[model samples]
Target: MRLRPPTNMVDPRAKRYWMAGEAISNGVVTLVLGLLAFLIEPARPWLLLALGVALLIGIPYMIIMPIWRFRVHRWEITEDAVYTRSGWLWQEWRIAPMSRIQTVDTKRGPLEQAYRLSRVTVTTASAAGPLTIKGLDHEVAADLAEKLTEVTQANRGDAT
Candidate 1:
């Protein structure tokens, strides 16, 4: 079936959240490489080279990925289904019909909580797995979960 972009974009603060998340992960890798470079004197040159290469890669990734993701990520919920588009390079689109949805849940990791953001998960019987709408405001995610739950329950079907 043909699909177009969803109607809503995720919260704008998600950009900062994504950057911070990538920064933390990249920071850890840099720290490890730096420590190894200092401690292993014989391999210092190679380690430094590795660190430089990592920075070259990580710096651009830290800058670009979040912006690209922000541009790509979108979600929309209607009376009949929930639609989402996500990912940066490897993009995905999903639609969960109310009749097929088995569960609706919201998730907030420590970082997401710090950013006051949440992810909404809609599980269906499809083998492809649950559909997620990430980077939503916490309150909005909760309301969306509730709305989806209500709609799915009202749909008269086995949710198969």
Candidate 2:
């Protein structure tokens, strides 16, 4: 059976947060290439070429990826499970059954903190690893984590 997209989209502010983070990381790579161009006299031309190429690719990636991801990224929680859809080029859809959930936590990195956003991570017994719902409002993520924790505790099972 085909799965439908999750019901809720991530916070709208996530787009700006994603773009800013990508720009910073891409900028760092470009900056390193530029510095190397200045430092190495013989390979200066090659380094500058690489820097130009980086800008050519990075600019579009910085702009387009966030927009695409904003449209794709979504999440939802029900009494039975938590659902999430994430990624731009390669999509991942995850469902963590309430009974299988081992832990639920919220996290905010420096960029997420700056954007006032948080991520909710749900760990399960499956070998696939934790499922993360990113770009949520900080308060919403906290509430989700707490609610999931409570539900998981009540539904404790091996899910075998």
Candidate 3:
């Protein structure tokens, strides 16, 4: 099915957090690889050069890719369910039917708090079936959690 945009689509502040984290992670990987190369094969300068090149290439990709992906990402809440589609290369689409949701949780970490963003995790009875929606505004994430809880409770009432 064609993806639908989120009703409350706003510019996610979490992009900066993600980019910063990505850069740090890539930098660490580059450092470790450089160290390993130096210790194991000090003669091979090419390995260190390759790692440097990867770091240089990766930083820009980390910055730009998220913006592009976020532009393409969509979330839709229909009468019966909520659907989310995201990612560039390995696109993923997830559907959380109201009936299947057992609980909805909202969380924010130090980075997320600094960026004023949060993540919403929806849990189901089925093992390995929970879904998380990340990079949402803190307030929006809380609201989504409340709505999901309400929907799930209402569905349970109907079933009984």
- For candidate 3, write residues 59-116 as lDDT tens digits: 8889887787767566667778878766766788788777777778999888778888
User: Model 1: per-residue lDDT, tens digit, 85-149?
Assistant: 99999999988777899988899999999999999988998788899988999999999999888
Q: lDDT winner among the candidates?
A: 1
Compare candidates 2 and 3 on TM-score and give the better one: 2
TM-score of the candidate numbered 3? 0.78
Any idea what lDDT model 2 has? 0.91
lDDT of predicted model 3: 0.75
The lDDT values for all models are 0.92, 0.91, 0.75
Off by over 4 Å in 3: 33-44, 157-160
Give candidates' CA RMSD values in order.
Answer: 1.3, 1.3, 3.1
Candidate 1 or 3, higher lDDT?
A: 1
Q: Who wins the TM-score comparison? A: 1
TM-score, model 2 to reference: 0.94
List the candidates' TM-scores in order. 0.96, 0.94, 0.78
Instruction: Please give the lDDT score at residue 102 for candidate 3.
Output: 76
Q: For candidate 3, which ten residues in a row score worst on lDDT?
A: 3-12
Identify the runs in model 2 with alpha carbons over 4 angstroms from their true place.
158-160
